[model samples]
Target: MIDLNNEKLELNYPCKWIYKIIGKNNQDIKKAVKEILDQREYVLKLSKSSKKGKFKSFTLELLVHNEDDRKMLYDILYNHDNINMVL
Candidate 1:
């Protein structure tokens, strides 16, 4: 028998990290995620973007493997000229 309440949840174990990516271009998000989180086990959650005449707003949620991976991704996207920002 197992008791759920008796178990303690520790964050020591490696878990996926989520990053909310914001940009003015959809292609930028795709490229950034690919260049950053691609080839690694991750899930990308994209928000519906509004169609503004000359402006665009988009968001992407990326699931990273660990802290190191998240840092690597941040550096990649942050340094990229096409990427607006990553949170």
Candidate 2:
């Protein structure tokens, strides 16, 4: 089996990246994403929700110019209070 823990993703710059964000409120998550992205071209889609309707998942798709930009976006979204997690 592949060791997922040790496997580092190899990706080319200026490619599409997806951020899977999960949180308690859909609107809150949407607002957070909007604020962070701030007029940048991107696609946001509602993926699914938890069984009890307690959590929501959204996928944010956008083109990242470089490793720093990609990682910066991830950090921005991950640090937001309205966002519970980002993957």
Candidate 3:
């Protein structure tokens, strides 16, 4: 039996990474991402929003140089005050 908890995902370096950034407002999230990325090349698209328009999600796609680079980006987005979640 494979121990899923002990397993890791194998991914090639310099690959495309996608992050779903969620926030209260799409405009605010867009501004926050611009500030956080700061000229870094990335593709941001409006993915979805809550039925009542309380929450919004954006898809952030970018090329990550390596595993560390990918994780670092995730950490940064997850820690930002403007971002509620990063997945």
Off by over 4 Å in 1: 1-10, 48-66
- The whole-model lDDT of each prediction reads 0.63, 0.94, 0.91
**lDDT winner, 1 or 3:** 3
lDDT of 3 by residue, 12-78 (tens): 9899999999999877898888988896899999999999988899999999999999989899899
Off by over 4 Å in 3: 1-6
Model 3, residue 8: distance off in Å is 2.0
Candidate 1 at 65: error in angstroms? Answer: 4.6
Segments in model 2 whose C-alpha atoms lie over 4 Å from true places: 1-8
lDDT of 1 by residue, 1-87 (tens): 777997875554255556666666766667767776556665666655557533344444445556676677778877787766667
| TM-score of candidate 3 on Cα atoms, chains taken together | 0.88
Worst 10 residues of 2 by lDDT: 1-10
